[model samples]
Target: MSRRVLIKTLPLHSNYGGILQAYALQRVVRDLGCLPVTDTSKPLPLQRRLRRRLWDVRRGIRMSLPARFDWRWRSAREATASQRAFIARHITGGSFVERAYTRRGRALLARRFRTFVVGSDQVWRASYADLPAQFLDVVDDLDGDRPRRMSFAASFGVDDIAEYRDGDRARVAELIRKFDAVSVREAAGVRICRDEFGVHAEQHVDPTMLLPADHYRQLAARAGVAPAPATGRLLVYRLDANDHLERTERELAERLGVPSLELLPTGGPSPSYREYAQNRSAYDLPSIEQWLACFASADFVATDSFHGCVFSILFNRPFVVYANASRGASRFDTLLGIFGLEHHLTSASSTAVDERVFAPDWASVNRVLDAERSRALAYLTANL
Candidate 1:
């Protein structure tokens, strides 16, 4: 029997980490001949899903596709029927809420899903958090049959689980207990799952980094964005309203004396990453292949995203990630620590360093990651 994974993905919101996580899971599932189904549920309700779907359709109509593009063709179509069902649920009204619970039709559809995966992002966050929708705490209901319970790479955005009051912690632990195996994307998350939620979780690199950078380069080459010329250009990707991002980038650009491609971004954590594609110039958001090619092309990279930093390291693109006053830095710290990448981050007020300064014998990182990936694959495959 094929195992059906009901995946809860963070809304695409154009973050590369979210995209990488979903695709990585799909790739691993494909290797196993098991279907991976996605359900992009944030903390929104049915009405919001309805509103968002309408908005997405309007955006879909206004947006032009890449030349030789066909929306109907999908790498996921070859997935199992269960996978298709999950996608349908995920794509529903652009909200997983409407797909699974907001509507009678979708609720009926979700009832048939046997195995569920709670995460690859911040799925445990409550409604008060900024996520678009919340998981319905159905782990208990789903656990009744003792179904194959697992969590892929759940992340809690903040480290202080103590901030929650009014029994939220109880709900969180209750929900976490239903899982048979657990893993998290960050060090704080590993701590939270063990200390707060009472689940033992191993730490792993983001799935996007699991595959080599060359693989993404091939994808980019297929998509047709030529490698960036060696023009000493800096690619700047920042979405947060960090007070000093512009000043730092400007300072860095002037110091490097290279024109920078600033990615002007817009969008929340939603189901479509088109927000990234939309806010960013078409030049910035290339196809996966082209994105990799550009990674190859960059003389240096500057950004504050985890996956952005990951690709930079994968290509050995010299770079630095300026820190933001946000809570998600634990994942950044964990991954960087794993690779001994301590020099890549600095506080916003610090003097800007040339991004070309990265130098580490990634030889150690490569060996550790390769071994971990192999063990993770063995674990996932054996349980299935």
Candidate 2:
């Protein structure tokens, strides 16, 4: 009988990457002869939620005042519905557990699963890292009977470990030390683990890359994505949009003589841009399959999202990444470096639209990807 593996990560919300990664990790675990499950637990208490909300609101205010009241709320509601539908359709193993934010909640989860896997996202970020539940601390009282602990592609979401408070840092270190096998998503994460926590960790690719490209193609086909456009268009999946990026995209599209289609961030549509007056918006929050299909069908992609760049590479489409510093630049650096596509990374101020057309050496890129896939597979199989 396959061992029951329970995964703990950020909740499946509007974030496409987070949802897709969770699905991918589940697939990886199942392929390794283990049953992978997730906790469909609800959000924590009102106090915690309020605190987190306040922090997020503060951050949004810092970034863009308008973002605080954009169509994101409606878009997120739609996106959440779509995400739930996708999870219901694709992920088959787990059943929803009640809200599990407290000590009792962790105990209940420990009792249900023999192996607890934490990873494939920034679950270790300071904001969410302090929770004992995330660390599998509920099982600590079980003594020798404690469940197996492992992490796959977990990220710190920042370059430095010092981003956490002194107490949080110590707590996180202790929890990490208890993991049987740990692997991080970024090279900086690997260094942080080794240099700061003294825990040796292997660098692994994002879970989305664990599956082959054809897997996503099949999903797109199932979703009924239209065939590639005859007069191909420029697809823009900008998570953090600003005037400069918008102008650059328009300029690039104009130069390439292609109509532009912009996939706005989680919320709703932004103010109209004259540059994109001829452009279109994928305003209806698309399902995960549709999202993947959008990337597959695009002639060219311009994005600042980590997963957008990821899918662009998967489809072997010509693309450019406008690195979003606030969202975490290290992730882009690590992923782009893996495919030897560092040249594609550019800043918002850059007006060099012509460089976006350069074709990547896919053969060399695939070879590196294949090797990394095997290593990630080995880590999952051995640990699980």
Query: Model 2 over residues 1-384: C-alpha lDDT tens digits?
Result: 779888877777678998899899988888888878875443456698678779878766654644334443433343356777888888764432333445565566656677888877887776644454566555565533767898899988779865677876677778888989988999999999998899999999999999998999798787676545312778888876567777778877887788987665333354233312333233346678778877888888888888999888888888888888777789999999888898888786665754635667888889998999998898888889
- TM-scores for every predicted model: 0.74, 0.83
Looking at model 1, report the run of 10 residues with the lowest lDDT sum.
Answer: 71-80
Q: Who wins the lDDT comparison?
A: 2
In candidate 2, position 134 carries an lDDT of 64
Give lDDT: candidate 1, residue 32.
Answer: 81
Candidate 2 Cα outliers beyond 4 Å, as residue runs: 40-76, 92-107, 128-132, 229-231, 265-283, 349-357
**Alpha-carbon lDDT of model 2:** 0.75
